[model samples]
Target: MLRVADIFGRFPQLETEQLILRKMRKDDARDLYEYASDPDVSRHTLWNAHRSLLDSQRFLEAVIEQYKSKEVTNWGIEHKADRKFIGTCGFVYWNPDHRRAEIGYALSKSYWNQGIMSEAAHAVMQFGFKKMLLNRLEARCNVENIGSERVMQKIGMTYEGTIREQLLIRGKFEDVKLYSILRSEVSLEC
Candidate 1:
């Protein structure tokens, strides 16, 4: 079994060929708002389109606070070329007793289809299984989110099943498709 203390004792930073996954800072609010405010970007997510910079700032503040606890871990995705915040990914739910976690991510529409999310998620999967000593890492996306489903598949997660009306997003109950990978299924080469 994984111990929360052992995993949260040190902050983890993940890197890919095109992106850096690190903790979000207050300074990233502007960049985060630029994309988070896009309705297209927020369409499939639970969060509504950000109306102003303050909205993004508030979100960042909450993410910052989560980092102070052992309950969650989030990383701001930074483009290596420009070092701009393009999105965020992290474990939204964790259970050390069960040795499992549920991951989530969002990317700027401008950066979509570039495989950045796949790379970032791949690294995160490694961290979850190896460093965190998690047996299972799972992800879920709205049934209509083909992009997110593709990312989950690219990361070697197997599609589990869709739960009907499993989530109430934007006041509507939405069906969510689940995917998961076990530590035994992933090579601990990270």
Candidate 2:
């Protein structure tokens, strides 16, 4: 039995060659805002581009609440080279009995094509399967999000199917592509 309390008791800090996946702090609002507020970043997602720092702050506050209860794991990706907080990745949802969880993430537009998200997501996937003992980890993204789909593929997740008009993003219904990787299928190498 996985206890949320136990998970929160010991904060999980994960690291990759060029990035660190850790808790999102209040101080991260500035960097978070830098990318999250960009129109390009939110274009394919359900949420709209943030208009101000307050929006990022409010989002951080909500994330902090989840951290307090350990209901979900969210990590802010930190680039060790420049010490810049680039983006975030983590388990957005989980089911203990089924040993399954849904992973989600976003990276700054400036950091795209750098394979940074793959590193961060790989670490998170390892934690979910090895530490959280998850049997299946899944990810979903807008069907038009090629970059996001690439990130999923880089982490060994296979494209399962597509959900038609599942997400009402911006003002229209958007199709979503689903991907998944079973515990036995996870490959930490690379």
Candidate 3:
């Protein structure tokens, strides 16, 4: 029997005033489906928004595999009030040579307007730049994703540039706005 603690050994369960950020698990699929199945939750995300329970299952499988392989740093975001998995927050594209990483996140709509994502971002960004020793952290969002942009800003990441038609999403070219925060700069903010 694999204890959840045995496989993970207690990842950093960061806490803010009202949220929790920690390692994700395969068992979270059922609780996560409540939000992961919503199109709105993944709309601005690079991955095509999940549309069904099966889609969420595939996602959960990938996340579980990622943990087992120690590939990327991904954290699940949960709201303390309800003890629910609202979304994920973490750095994905890690470049040790460049000392940089790419961050991505998604949260359920029910938790929007509550500033939970911003708190999660702050904690994760700190872990990446300071604890993980990353020199640069980047976040990109669809140009129309004002909410995501705001979260980046709240975490003190600087808006850097926009890549026109940088990605193809659902068969259409989409513009992406890039933001960056260097370890030196992030340290000042912290």
Candidate 4:
């Protein structure tokens, strides 16, 4: 029985060979703005491209508050070598009763096609199943988002199917491809 408080009492920090996944700070606004302001990075995401640094600051403010309230939030993905905030990855929704959760992520365009997102997603999925005791972990991406779909596949999630008009993004209904991986399907080891 996972409660928001139980899992988010303290935001967990995760790491990989090239990235550090942790709670975001105010100082990350510049880095967040750097990528989030790019239309290419926000094109496939539901959120609009940030118009200014204030937009990123406002977003961080909300996330910081969400952390205090133990609400669903994401981890800031920091590139180890650059020590820059390059993206975010975490559970966007969790269903304790069903032991299921949905993950979401976004990465800077410069970091794309380098397997950075796959490594980060793998860590988040492992946390969902092992720490949260989730029976099912799922992810969904716009049908046209090949990069996102590849991340899902790289992490071993099976594509279920495309749902017609599954999400309203940027004022338009968009079809989405759903993918999921069960606990039994994962090795559950580092």
Clashing pairs in 3: none
State the displacement of the C-alpha of residue 115, model 2, in Å, after optimal TM-score superposition.
0.3
Q: Estimate every model's Cα lDDT from 0 to 1.
A: 0.89, 0.88, 0.80, 0.95
Q: Which one wins on TM-score?
A: 4
For each candidate in turn, the TM-score is 0.95, 0.95, 0.88, 0.98
Question: Candidate 4 on 44-147: residue-level lDDT in tens?
Answer: 89899999999999999999999999887899999999989999999899999999999999999999999999999999999988899999999999999999
Ranking by TM-score: 4, 1, 2, 3
Residue 86 alpha-carbon offset, candidate 1, angstroms: 0.8
| Cα lDDT of model 2 by residue, 1-190, tens digit | 9876666656788888999888888999999999999999988876678899999999889888888876776788999998999998998888888999999988899999999999888888988888778999999999889999999999999999999989887678889999999988876444
lDDT of 3 by residue, 1-190 (tens): 2233332344567777788887787777877788876778778766765567677788888877777766666789878898888898887677666677888888888888788889888888887765567788999999999999999999899999999999898888999999999877865335
Model 2 CA deviation exceeding 4 Å by range: 188-190
Please, what are the lDDT tens digits per residue for candidate 1 over residues 1-190? 6676567656677888899998899999999999999999999998899999999999999988877775576789999998899999888888988888999999999999989999989888888887878999999999999999999999999999999999999789999999999988998873
Instruction: Give the C-alpha lDDT of model 1.
Output: 0.89
How much does each candidate deviate from the true structure in C-alpha RMSD? 1.2, 1.6, 4.8, 0.8
Instruction: Per model, state how many residue pairs clash.
Output: 0, 0, 0, 0
